[model samples]
Target: MTITYEETRELAQRTVVDARYPNINIYTLDAIWVLYDRVLRVDPQRIDDPARDRFLLSKGHGPSAFYAVLAAKGFFPAEWLDTVADLESPLGSHPDATLVPGAEISSGSLGHGLPLGVGVALGQRATGHRDAQVYVLVGDAELDEGSNHEAIAYAGAVGLANLNVIVADNDSASHGWAGGIASRFAVNGWSTATEDMHDHDALYRAFTAPHPDRPHVTVATVRT
Candidate 1:
C-alpha cells in the first residue's frame, strides 16, 4: 500500500506512543519526528547518489520515524513499515545499513554512531566528496557511555567540518533532562544549539550549515 508522508509521520508518532510500556527508557514517537524530520537529509531511491547527504540514526530505537521517512521517500513499499521489528521484517528496531538503503550505519548500541559518523566524514574528505555531510542522531541518555565523549573529542581534534552530531534531547533521558550535554559539546569545540526538537525549520538550518573549521554539533533539547 502507498502511504503519504503525512500518514507515515502520524504512524510513527502513534507507534512510539503505543508500542512501549508506560515505564520504559525508550524514546517517544514525538521525539522521533522531532529529530528525523529536522536533522536528516535523504533521497530514498537515489540514496547512494554521491550528492545525497548521509544520515545515521544513532538513537536507534527511533526507527519509527526513520522507517516512516524511508517509506514516504519510496525506499520501499510503505506497507513494509507495519512489519518493522517483526521476526520476518528487514526493518529492525534499529537500522541495519547493509539492509537499509538510506542508513549509514547499523546501530542499537549507543556511543558508536558519532565515531562512525566522524569516520564517514573523514572518508568523504579523503575521497574528495567534501560536500557530503554525515549527520548522527544520538540519544541524550546514551551519553552514559564514555565513548560518546571520545567521539566528540576526536571530531574536534580532527576538525570534521562536514560532520554533524545531533543529540535528541527529549526531556526523558537520565531522570528527566540530560544535564550539561550542550556544555560538554561546546567544551569539545563543537558549535551547539538547544531548541524544541520538533521545530523543523530551525533544525533544518542547523543541520545544513557547515562549521567553518570544526565539527558541527547540535543538541536538540526536545520536550516530547
Candidate 2:
C-alpha cells in the first residue's frame, strides 16, 4: 500500500525530541516526500543492490522527514520513528548511513554531501552501473562551503549525466548567489531547473528531465 502524504507528515510528527528544533524538518518535508514517493528507484527490500539509485541527505541536521518517508516506504519499521534521537535509537538528529537502512551517507556537516555524491556517481559509472543515478539533497546555506563549489565544477566538467542535486532553497543562504541559485550550477555547465518545492508535478518533471552530457540541479524554492 502506498502511503499518503498526510500519513507521512503524521509519521514525521511522531518524532518529537528536541524543543529547540520543533520545525527544523518542515521545510524539507515535501521535497523528500516527493522523491521517496515518486522519483527514487531504490527498493527497501534490496538496499545493498549495486544498481539501486542513491539518495544522500546532506542537510541531515533535521531528518524527521527523511525518517518518516523511509519508514512509510518500509526501509525501517514505523516503531523506530517514536524513538528518534533517543540514546539507543539508530535514528538520530543527523542520519548515519551505518545505522539507517536506506541512508547512503552519514551526513551532518554542510558542503560534504555534494562532493561525496560526485564520487558516488563517478564510482557507479566506473563500475559499469551506467543506469544508476545519484541524488543529493542540500540546503541553500550548505552551498556556501567551498567543497561543494569544487564538486559542482568537477561534476559539470566531467559530464556526470547520472548525477543530480536538489537544493532546498528557503532563502537561507548567507551569501546569496547572483542571478539566483540555478545560475551558479548553470554557469558550471550543469542543466538547471527552478521549481516551487510544493509543486509535486513540477518537482517530478525537474527530477526526471533529460541532461544528456552533464549533471543536473533542481533548485526547489520553498516558503521560509
Candidate 3:
C-alpha cells in the first residue's frame, strides 16, 4: 500500500491523544514524512538491524505525526494509534521506545534527541557500521535548551557526517537567534540547509546532500 502525505496525515489526525491541544501540527508531519520516505535508509521489516538508520523525535510533544508515519511505514499496526494515551496502550501522548516498536528513544522533555543521536551516530561508526545514519527531529523552541547547543557543537567538532538534524521552525521559540537557526549549526562546522517544510523536492535534496567531514542540519520553516 503506497502512502501519500495526505493519507498519512489523515492517520495522524486520528491519533490525537489530547483534547486541550486539539489540532495536529500537519506542517511538522509533512516535513517528517518527506525525510523519512526519501532520505532515511531503514527497513520497517528489519527495524532491529544493526545497520539500519535511526530516527529520533526530539520535539516529542507533537508526536501524532511520528506515530502516524511509523505506523504507515509498518513499524506497528495502525490500530494501535486509536488507543493512544489509554492506560493499557503503549501509544502514549509521548512515545516510549521500550513499548513502541519503532521509537529509538523515549522523549517528551526537550533537548535530548540530538545528543542521543550524536551518540548513536558515533557508536555506529565506532563499531564499524559505515552505512547507518542518525536523524533527529527538534522544534525551534528546543534550541533554547543548552544541551542541544553542546550536542551541536560536539557533533560538528567530531565530524559526525552520519548525523542529521531537522529543526521545525514555527517561530515558537521564546528567544530568537540573530542569523537564524541554520547559522548556529553552520558556525559549528555543520552543513546547513533552509527550506519550506512543505516543499518535498527541496526537503529531499537537502536531506540527501553531501556533508563531508561535518554533520548536517535542515531548518524546515513553517508558517508562524
Candidate 4:
C-alpha cells in the first residue's frame, strides 16, 4: 500500500515527533521528506519514467524514511507503510526496486550504491536519457569499507557527473576515516561540498547546484 504526498508528510513528521520508529534515524527520515517534497522527481504514478532521476538511498538502514516518503507519494497506499518491513509486506527492511515502485536499488550492504548509481547513469545514457541523474546516498559509517572508495573514484574519473553522491557522514567511522572523505572526493577530481544535512536549505542548495565537472560528491555531515 502507498500514501498520498500530504498524508506521507503527516505520518513521517508525526512518527518522528512521537518516537514511533526508534531504530529509524530521525534525520534520515527528514532527508526523505526533503527528497520527496523537493528534490527527487519520481512520479507518483509513473515511477519508472526514463527521464526521471533515480534516487538510491545507499544507506539502507533508513528504510523507514523511504517508506514514509513513498507512501506520501502514493506509490501504493499510505496505510501500507505501517506494514513495511513485515513478513507479508512488499516493502522489506531494505528497499527492493522490484517491489517498491519508486525504489531504484535493493540496498543495505552499503558499499554498492555508488557503483549502482554509476551503472544507472550508464544505462540512462545508453537509453538516450542522458540528462537524467542517478543520485545515491551513502552512510559515513559505511565509508570505512574500502569498496566505496573505488566506486567513488570510478564515478569521478569516468566523468559520470550525472551521478550525484550524497554521503551522510555521521563522523563515527573508525578513527580517521570520515575526516578525509570529503577531501578525498576533491582530490579525486569530484566537485564536492560539505554541509549540514539537517539544514534543509543548505541541503537543497548543495544538491541542486551544478557540478563543475562530471561526478559530483556532496558530503552531508549529519548527526544521529
Candidate No. with top lDDT: 2
Q: What lDDT would candidate 3 get against the real structure?
A: 0.88
10 residues in a row with least lDDT, candidate 1? 17-26
Looking at candidate 3, the ten consecutive residues that score lowest on lDDT are 18-27
In order of appearance, the predictions have TM-scores of 0.83, 0.96, 0.96, 0.87
Tell me the TM-score of model 4. 0.87
Off by over 4 Å in 4: 1-10, 13-22
- lDDT per residue (tens digit) for residues 1-224 in model 4: 44454565566554331135454454565456666678877787787688998888888865766777776777767666666666677777677778887788888787888777888889998999887877888887788777888987887787777888888777767665644678878877788878887787787887788874678877887765
lDDT of 1 by residue, 124-169 (tens): 8888888777878788788767788888888888777888877877
Steric overlap count per candidate: 0, 0, 0, 11
lDDT of 2 by residue, 1-224 (tens): 87899999899887764557776456788888888888889999999999999999998888888888999999999999888888999998888899999999998888889989999999999999988999999999899898999999899988999999999999888777767999889989999999999999999999999898999999999975
For each of the candidates, the C-alpha root-mean-square deviation to the true structure, in angstroms, is: 3.4, 1.2, 1.1, 3.5
Give Cα-based local distance difference scores for all models.
0.70, 0.90, 0.88, 0.74
Indicate the worst ten consecutive residues by lDDT in candidate 2: 16-25
Clashing residue pairs, candidate 3?
none
Q: Considering lDDT, which of the candidate structures 2 and 4 is the better prediction for this target? A: 2
